[model samples]
Target: MIRQYDLVERVKSYYPAVDESLLNRAYVYAMKMHGSQKRASGDPYFSHPLEVAGILTDLKLDPATIVTALLHDTIEDTEATHEEIARLFGEEIAQLVDGVTKLTRLELTNEDSKQAENFRKLILAVAKDVRVLLVKLADRLHNMRTLEHIRKPESRRRIAQETMDLYAPLAGRMGMQGFRDQLEDLAFAELNPEARDAVKSRLDLKQEKSRDLVVRIADEIKRRLAAVGIEAWVSGRTKTAYSIWKKMERKSIALEQLSDIYGFRVVVDSVDDCYRALGILHGAWPMVPGRFKDYISTPKGNNYRSIHTTVVGPERERVEMQIRTLEMHEVDEFGVAAHWFYKDYVENGSKKSVSASDELVAPFRWLREVVEMLEHDATSEEFLEHTKLEMFQDQVFCFTPKGRLIALPRGATPIDFAYAVHTDIGDRCVGAMVNGRHMALRSELQNGDEVEIMATGQQVPPLSWDDIVVTGKARAAIRAHRRRAEREQYVRLGRGIVEASLRTEGLPVDEAALEVVVHDLPASTLESLFEQVGRATLNVETVVRAMLVHFTPEKKSRRPKIKGAKVAAGSERAREDGTLPRGRPDAIPITGAGVGTSVTLSPVSLPIPGDRIVGIMQPGKGVEVYRIDSPALAAYDDDLDCWIAVKWDIDADEHRQFPARIALVLANAPGVLGEVATVAGKHGANIENLTTTDRKPDVYEMTVDIGVESAQHLERLLTGLRGLKSVSSAKRVYG
Candidate 1:
């Protein structure tokens, strides 16, 4: 085990002001808290925190952050508490430790969800205090480095994938090139061992063969810079496994297609020297066409500044070169951590605002746009997935109509852009113009293409818009608009039920008649009433009765005084004649047996406009219509008409399906489904469904459907398919 003194010495570079007493106390406390706990590597668990602290120390973070790293895992994994940590250390250190502790304890539904939520929290924490993320990134960096100690392949893959998918991307976002490269390379090794080995072997062979050439070129560049009176440091860099994988994917070429795999960097004293050195390097070697990028003028989203160029060397071999200042190099290596030293001095000891890394911080205006996307009443999953597509996915830069730049993820369209502008515009979008040419809503945006959204004031969003819009914000806004529209529909439906009942009771309701009553109830009250009804609180019929009674109170029986009209005593004729359809009425024909007209026993089974219908006729009463398969009529044993006859509309396509088991058998040959496509083209059948299982030893089972117009057509196809080489069998599964 490493001693506390050695760890303290390692951390001293960042914290010369930190005394030995603080270090000793933290070490003892961490050890006490983690007593006898061992990692899967079988070493003491203290090694993990020591390594984490060392990583933070290398970043040259504050002493408190370093100490917090030492104790970060204590509270979560052991008996240590936040109050205890605060009591032992100062509040700042305790807060950081608690933040990390909370991060450690978070339970995600799955690794990806957990990681995304963690990243969200981590970024928020970083926004509050940048050091929180620094410690976390360092901690993740060390964990990734030591991932081999994990036993399960799945666990290793999960951690590696998370590192590759999230942490490495985050490191790139933070401008930590060195850490990002290493994490990606490490992840690649685990996730794709074969490709990793192949790239490694090829690069190693190339490096061995070109060792002398690299040295000579580096030396020449160093000498050229020295001659120009520009002090510089130059070194060669070998591309890592993940970088080669990315190159292979991007260029659609194998390892042999890659040249200039060996790159060199020239770090100088000043920004001017960086540019001067770039010019000198160009002069030394013939520049490759369109292979130069001056990031110094336009830094990357992560605040990385460099002038990168590839050149054909003396041996006619391509070599990539990067030129940057030493400060830029440090910032490239340490990312946001490097800002601490200079920013502290510049800010005069006060903590700098989140904007301190303005040059380094990725534009979060996109996040604000995402928040707006979520402003729509989108479900959590839809909102989260869409935001993930924008925030967590890779970014593509496009131009707005005015030539201003707008960055979105790959495959984002103008609809996403319109929504990003505002919800109303997105909801009303009718069309779009890409570079001033009208295109479909699904037209993918290309890099640097000027996109103009064409919206209309008269148009409402289509239901299909939910499927087409890609951005989370836009999808959410569209969904929200639809949801509010749906709620309004429900409100109208509910109001209609109440008003129609009032009219039948001789208290007719219209906009003019009900407007006063409606004005008495606010939207909040209406919402509450709906909620109560939805929750099965206040009965709908009772509510209707109360409203009618309130609007038109019951008056005492009286005789009307008309000119020369005979006066009569209190007449019960209208009330007792039963002309109204209150309970069960007479004279109206009931369709089925034992059913009444105008009398619905249960409101739970009320027939609406959209409902399928059935009728039941009663002896003195009239026909009582009932919904098919209503739970309210389930107990009626003798009354068959109470069951009602109903059928769904033949043209209605509004069927919703739960999960169903589908079995598929793919052809047992190489490239068979590509084979099936060739075979399917022979037949006039279109594949409506396809699903496959994981690969087994030989034959793969996949469920596929070839749509047929009729049962005879399906049978004809099946009969012909009995022994057609790849078609072993075909069957339909009802489930």
Candidate 2:
């Protein structure tokens, strides 16, 4: 264990005016609180926090961070309380300790939810004070270092997977490459021990065979740069086993085929020297095409800056090199910690303000967005989904019309860009322009493209928009809108059913009576009761029957039956041949069709304005519309009392098109798809989408979505498709 005096001296080495007395007090408190506790490694439990503090010292973090690292586990494992820590240390340290404690105490039912819920709390906590995250990362790093001592293999694997999925990516996003690399390697060792060991053995053999290769390369780079009068420090090393294995797997190549496994870094005194050093290195070797990137000019969202290039150098070997200024080097290695090195610390026992400056806080914009998302009405599973989408994708930086930069995932669409701008914009977006040219709303955004969103005043978003967007914000917003719309639709249908049912019973539904009935039920409001009825949770007949029993106990009434238009069996139905249909005064019109609707010949064998449609009233659920012979109608035969009569509106426009789905089994041969397309076109059918799958060596199955004028038109198209020699089967798929 590190001595208290030695720890204080280490802090003073970087922060000479750090609060030494406070540090001493915290050290003693942690040691005393954790008395008699032993780690899985059989060492004093105090040694864990001590080692965590030692790790943060290497990052040169603020004194408060170092202190919090010492006490992060106290409230969770020891008898210490947050209030006591506050009284002794201060509120800042107490708050940080509370945050870490909450993270530690998360108990979830399964691993997936556990990981997501833990990250949810982590984001919320870190949004207030970034130092809390820094301290927790250090804590996780130390725990991983001692993970081998844990007895159970399953427990170790779970911890390693979580570290790889959560902590490592977070550290990388924060620009802490050193921490990210170490965490990944440690986790990889447990998750894939054989693969890791094999890669390590290969690396060890390479290192032994080329004992002086790294030194020779570093010396040669130094000698060349010195000749150019550019003072620089050049260092080289082999990539980590995890990174090497990942590269090989990603490229589908053997280890020997990898050329950039050996890498070098050149740190200089000034930004000018960084470019100058790059020029000298390139001048001395042949540059590799498509392998150069200038992150210095266009830094990553994490604020990482460097110039990377691959070149054939020193013995004609392909090598990777990164050049940056000394300041950039420090910031790249230590990330946010380097920023605190120059800040003034609190003195005289006064507390420092927790708020950070805009520049210092800018890199955490994604974190703030996540916090905002938590406020939305999303379930734990949904929260996890969006957060994972936000965390685990490479970014493409684009510009708004006004030159504002918006960073998004590589495959994000314009809808995602709109959501990134603001939620309102995304909800109302109708179209977009990319780089001043109108493009499809689902078009993938490219780096540096200027996006312009065209939004309308409409409040409801399209349900299909969910499939077009890739970002979490856009998907979440679309889902929220759809949920609200579905609720309203259900409520409307439920109200109509209840009102009609009451009229049949010769009773009036008044607000007072409705309120009384709602109060007697499980619902909190009249609207909620109606919503329940619409959702089929509460049977409309039951509510009406209950209402009659309460409002008119002396009168016995018969249940209302749905009246249907009487038609002779096998009578000529409304045909889609553009002929006028015989009018029935008793027919009820379907919603969306105006009065005096006429049944038209449907172009496809699909639901058309003139189909034999009926409405099925569910108990609490409103009504579901289905064709008379449809497969869905078979599901509700047990509840025949809920069935209602419905018909096509005669006033529906004849020019409107309806979609139809068709399945075709065809002989596997060239020109078969073309022949099907030709047949569809000849019948005036528009193919909207088509998917082909191989069912056998010589046969294929195809599903096609086509738009047609009427059911007759669709029948003609299906007949035409069946006439083709390549097509073995053709039929309309009914829902």
Candidate 3:
């Protein structure tokens, strides 16, 4: 364990202006608070915080961060209070300590929820001040180092998994590669010890066999750079065990097949010298094909900048190399800590401050994005899902038409790009062009591709966009819109059902009376009650029955005569022609004589030319509509009690698309699939999806989802398929 004075002296070395008395007070306070406690390793509990503080000192963080490391666990494990810490160290350090304390008191039901909630809190804390993350990372590092002493395999595994899943990635995102590698290796050992041990053994053997190869390559690189009049330092090392194993698994190759496991770094004095060193090295050796990335021109979101390349070197061995300036190297290793180091140096008047923007260099922007996501209403599971998608995927850089750069995760589509640009743009996007040509909205973006989104003020977001977009922001926005739309649809359906029920009971459709009754129910508003009924959570019949008990019926003689609902002109013409109405209506409008009341056409058997098809309200689900004799009606036998009467409006449009499923049995031979597709295409049917269920000696069963203009259009497609000699049978699947 590092002694108190030694730790203070280390911090003072980098930041001489740090308050020595504050450091002494924090050290003594933490030690006293944890006096009689012992860690799982059978050592003084204070030793853990002391070690964590020592780790932060190595990072050369600000004084408050080091102090935060010392007192992070006091409020959680001891009698120490936040008020006392504030009184002693001031509110900044106190808040930092409070933020670092693990969220253990949340009463979540499952372990996943609890873990997600804890992470959510940690992110919110880090968004306020990034040092909270720095200190928390150091605290976790010490715990991981001592994890083996816990003695409980399950506890150890859980901690290791959390570290691997959350903390390690966070460190990497902060550009702390050294910290990330250590955390990952330690966690990998506990999570999959056998695999880790195997990789380690292989690495050891390789290192032993290549004893002088790394040194020889480093020396040769140094010599080459010197010959070019470039002052540089070269170093080499074997990749970490976790990294090697991950690459092998990702590529599905054996350990021996890994060619770039040996890596070399060339550190130069300036950015210009870094590129100059790279040119010299590439000229000296044969470069591996497709093994170069120029991150210096376009740095990573974490601000990692280096020139990475693979080249055949001195011994004809394939080696990976990274070239960067000394400053970039420092940032790559220490991340945000390097900024503090530079800041401190500038304050001491020993060096000039770099011109990088603090916002671009800090990790808080990403942290704030996560914190903003929490403001939207999403389930714990959903929040975790989106956050993992945001944090874990590799990134691809794209460009706007005007050349502005936008970085997104791999497999992200234009929807994600639009959202990344602005929320309004995503909401208004109607189409997109990739590389100056129109493409599908779901087309995945590639690196360096320029995208131009076409927007329209009148367009609402497509319901299918939720699946096409991969980013959390786009998904959250899409889901929010869908939820609002669904609620509106439910409210409309519920109102129709209530009015139809009232009309059937010979009761007056009084909106005022219904509002009074709805106020007494579980719902807070009349619209909410209708929405509940439409979603089938509240049964329409139950609400009608409740209202009937509260309402008094008017005298029969005084009641006004209700007018008969009119059928659409097209339906009337079809009835006169003795033909059934086979086309779907653009809008299914309900009609009745009473204001705000819908009347159901009686003897609701099969839908006739004059009969209207309306939906039945189901709880949680919005509605289910089916024509009588349809296959879907069979499934609703159990929901017969919830059915309500509905009708089509006279002004309903004739042109509208509806989903239809068709199954076909085709001859299991060449050209049969194409023949069936041709038959459907000849009838103007758009095939959305196709799947084969079973294959026999002579026949195959297949299902296709087709979009049709109406029942008549679907029937025409079915007839065309039935006419094909290759199709054994074709029929509409209504369920």
* CA lDDT of every candidate: 0.64, 0.77, 0.76
lDDT leader: 2
Weakest lDDT window of 10 consecutive positions for candidate 1? 561-570
Q: What is the TM-score of each candidate against the true structure?
A: 0.66, 0.82, 0.82
Q: Flag regions of model 3 displaced more than 4 Å.
A: 102-110, 340-362, 498-519, 525-527, 540-615, 629-641, 649-654, 659-734
Query: Model 2: per-residue lDDT, tens digit, 107-191?
Result: 4334676667767777877788777788878988999999999999888888888888888988887778899999999999999
Question: Which is the better candidate, 1 or 3, if ranked by TM-score?
Answer: 3
RMSD of each: 13.8, 6.7, 7.1
Total backbone clashes of candidate 1, pairs 3 or more residues apart or in separate chains: 11
Residue-level lDDT of model 3, residues 1-735, one tens digit each, is 898789989998988888899999999999999999999889999999999999998888878889988898899999999999999999978988887774333323338887777677767667677777788788889899999999989888888988888889889877888999999999999999999999999988988998999999999999999997998889999999999999999999999888888999999998899888888888999999988888888788777889999999889999899999988998899887676542435556577543222555645466667667776676666677777878778888999988898888899999999988987899899889999999899999998899999998866678789888999888877776666766676688677666656655555567787876876678888888888877778876677667778876453212111123332222343324422233211133543211021222222232322323544445576554445344444445454454443444432254434456789999999998788778777887778889998989999898887767656677778888888888879987643
Worst 10 residues of 2 by lDDT: 576-585
The alpha-carbon deviation from the true structure for residue 467 of candidate 1, after best TM-score superposition, in angstroms, is 5.3
